[model samples]
Target: MLETIGINPAELAASETLLKLLISTALLITVVVVVRALSARYIRRNVASMELRRRWLVHSRNGLLLFMLLGLIIIWGEELRTLALSVVAIAVAFVVATKELILCVTGSILKAGAGSFNIGDRIQVKDFRGDVIDQSLLATTILEVGPGKLTHQRTGRMIVIPNALFVAEPVINESYTHDYVLHVFTIPFKRTANWQAAQQALLASANEHCASYLAEAKRYLKRLNEYRGLDAPSVEPRITLQMPSAEEVHLVVRIPVLTDRRSSIEQSILSEVFSQQEFSGAKEKALEQEGSAPTG
Candidate 1:
C-alpha cells in the first residue's frame, strides 16, 4: 500500500515493523482480558477459600504481564534488537530500584501460599502484636494490641505495616491452628506477703474463668496429637513465679481464652483474684501493720 503512494523501501520496512508491534500488543491485551475473565469466573465458581481465590487471580495477572513482555520480545526480535536490548536494560534497573515494592508483592504471594496468617489471626512480628484485619499488595493492617495497657486490650489504633516486613522479621502466629490465645499476666505482691497463697488464688481464678477454654483446649489438643502427633505441652492452667526484685514477687498465671475475648477474660481473672478473701484480708493486714508502726 505504501509503494502505491511512492514511499521509499526503508520507510516501508519501518512502517511494517511498527504495524507488527501494534498487532502483537493488541493481541496480547485481548488474550490477557479473555484469560482473566475466564479464570475469574472459574475461580469464583469452584474455589472455596476467598484468600486462595484472590491469590489465584493475582497470579494470573502477573503471568499475563510476563507473557506480554515475552510476546513483545518475540514480535520485535531481529530488526529491533537494539530497542529490545535497551528495554531489557531499563527493566532490570527499574526492578532493582523498586526492590522493596517487589519484595512486598512477593511477600504477599508467599503469605497467601504458606497460609502463614489470615484475617482475625492473632500475630506478633517484632514489637507489633495484633489481629490481622486487612491485607493488600503493599501492606497489612492490624487491630493493634497491647503492652502499654492492661487486659491485652486494643490501643484503639490501626497499624499499617509493610508486607515486606514479613520477610525481614520473625512472624509469630499465636492463634494459627487454634482460635485461642494463652493469656499470661502477673500479679505482684510484697516479698513479706503470702505469695504462695496469692499464686493459688490466681490459679483457681484462671481455672474458673477458663471453663470453656479448658474444655475446648482438651479437645483441640487431643485432635492435634491424634492427627499430627504433636508432642505439645500441657495447656492446663499454670502459675509461674517471677521475682523482679527481692522486694517484689509476681505470680504469673497462664491460661487459654478465645483470641477476641482476651481483655474480658483477663478482667474476669483479675476480678476473681482480687475478690478472693485471702487477697483482701492480706491487704487489710498489711495496712494495719503499717499503721501500728512508729511514725518516725
Candidate 2:
C-alpha cells in the first residue's frame, strides 16, 4: 500500500504508530462526549430514583470507558500488554500503602448498597453515634446527637467516618426499621399533687401530638398478635408514672415522632402538658404564697 502511494515503506511504518495513537485519542474523546450527552438526556427523561441513577452512571461510565481505552491500547501495540502488567503492579503498591483508606471506602459502598444505613437514620456504630447527614465514596457524615433526644450536641461538628468501620464494628440503627422514634421525658411532681391526673394529662399530650402514626403502628401490632396468637395492647398512647425519688413522682412521657424530630416532640409534649391551667394552677398558687412570704 505504501509503494502504490509513492511513500517509502520505512516512512509509512514510522508514521503508522503516530496515526494509530491519534485515532485512538479521537475515539476516546468521542466516547466521552457521547456518553456524557446520553447520560444527561436519560436522566432528564427518566427522572429515576437518585441513588439508582448515580449507580447507573458510575458503573456504565467505568465499564464502557475502561473497555474502549484498553481495546485501543491492545490494538495499537501488542507491547501494551506489558504496560497493563506494570499498571497492575502499581495498583498493588497503592493497596499496600493505603490499605485502611481503601478498606473504609469499600465498606462504605457495601453498607450503603446493602441498605444497612441511610441518611436520616439514627445510627450508633462503634463509638460514634448520630443521625446520618450524608454518604460519600470515602466517608459517611453524621450530625452528632445524644441518646436522650435528637439534640445536636456537636452543633458545628460533622462526623466523617471511614466506611471500613462497618466491617470492623456492629452498626446499631434505632430508626432503620422503625419509621417513628420514641422519646421519653421525665417531669417531677410534688408529693401532694394528684399523680393520676398528671399521668392522664401527659398521656393526652402524647396522643395529641403523635396520633397520626398510631394507626399504622397498631396495624403492625395487630399482625404480630395474629402470628403469635397473643393479645396486643391498644395502640392508644400511655404514660407511666413512677416514684424513683422520695420527694417527687416521675411522670414518664413517651411520645413518637421521626428520629430527627425527637427533641422537638419532647419539648412540645412537655410544654403543652405542663402549661394547662388545670395542671399548673395549684403549683402557681403555692409559688405565689411562698414568694409573698419574705425569706430574710
Candidate 3:
C-alpha cells in the first residue's frame, strides 16, 4: 500500500504526524461516547427537575459533538482544513434550505432556557390546545384536548407546534402554577322550573367534587395578586340567579374545577342539576334532547 503511494512501508510507519493525528481522532471519539452515555444516564435517573434534565441532556450531547469535531479539525487541520471548510459550506447550504426549522430550533432553546413553558402546562399556541408532554429543539409536543368537536379518548393526536410561534403568537397558559380553574355552568329553564332548587343542587354537587379546590385557589389567587402588586384578593364563591328571558329562569353556578377533572366535574354537576330540575311536558322533551349533547 505504501509502495503505491511512493513511500516505503518503514517510512510510512515512522511518520509521527500521521500516528499523532490518528491517536487524537480515536481519543476524541472515545470522549464523545463516554460523555454522552454518562449524561444520558444521569439525566434519566437522578435529576428530579424535568426542565433541568432536558437542558442538560441537549447541551451535553451538543457540547460533546462540537468538541470532538473541533478536536478533529485541530489534529488533522494542516491536511484537512479544505475538507472541513467544504463540509461547513454544505451544512450552511442545508441550513439555508431549512431556515424556518433553524429559527424554530433557536426559539425552542430560548423558550426552554427562559422558562416560558414547561411539561404538564395546559397551553394553547398557534391554534393548538393541549397539555405539553415534551419540548424539542424545533418543536413542542402536546397531548391534544378541548378543541371544538374533539373530546375524550386522550384524542391520541400529538400536535407539533413550532416554537418560533412563541415569539410571534400569544400563548394561553391555563395551568401555569395553579391546577384549579373556575368553571361556570349556566342553567336556563322555563319560568315554571325550580330555578332556585336547581342552582342549590348544582352548587352542592360542585362542592362535593371540588370544595378543597376553593381553598387552594384562594391561596393561589393571593399569591398571584401579590406578585402582580395588588391587595388581598376576594376568596368567596359567587353564585347568581337571574331571569334572562321572560319565560326562562337562569341559574349560574360558579365553582372550582380541578384541571385534570374539568370534564368529569362539569358532567357530574350538569347531570345532577338536570336531574333535579322540574320542567313542563314539552320542556322535558327539550331538556332530554339537550342532555344528550356534550358540554365543553
What is the C-alpha local distance difference test score of each model? 0.77, 0.70, 0.72
Give a tens-digit lDDT track for model 3, residues 1-296: 76987988777665866788788889889988988998899888998887677767766776776688788878888877656666987888888999888789778767867677677777877668887777666778888886442232257789988877876787777666455666555667777655556666766777776666678778876787788688854545456878777887777766665667767877877787677665435556668889999999
Best by TM-score: 1
Q: 283 in model 3: Cα distance from truth in Å?
A: 9.5
Residue-wise lDDT of candidate 1 within 70-175, one digit each (tens)? 8877776775777666698788898999999999988887787878887667788888888777777778888888864343677888999888988778788877
- How badly does each model clash, as a count of residue pairs? 0, 1, 0
lDDT winner: 1
Q: What's the TM for model 1? A: 0.69
**Model 2 segments more than 4 A misplaced:** 1-93, 126-133, 143-157, 182-197, 220-235, 240-252, 258-261, 277-296
Better of 1 and 3 by lDDT: 1
What is the model-wide C-alpha lDDT for candidate 3? 0.72
Per-residue CA lDDT of model 2 for 1-296, tens digit only, reads: 76888989887786887787778778787877797779867865696676556555555655565667676766666656656676997888888999998898779667867788765677888778886766666678887766434343445557888888887788887774355555556777776666667787777778888777777766765776687688865656667778877877877766656655667777777678667735534665677789999887
Model 2, residue 6: C-alpha shift (Å): 19
Using all chains and alpha carbons, the TM-scores for the candidates as numbered come to: 0.69, 0.56, 0.61
Candidate 3: RMSD to truth: 8.5
Residue 150 miss distance in model 3 (angstroms): 9.6
* Of candidates 3 and 1, the better by TM-score: 1
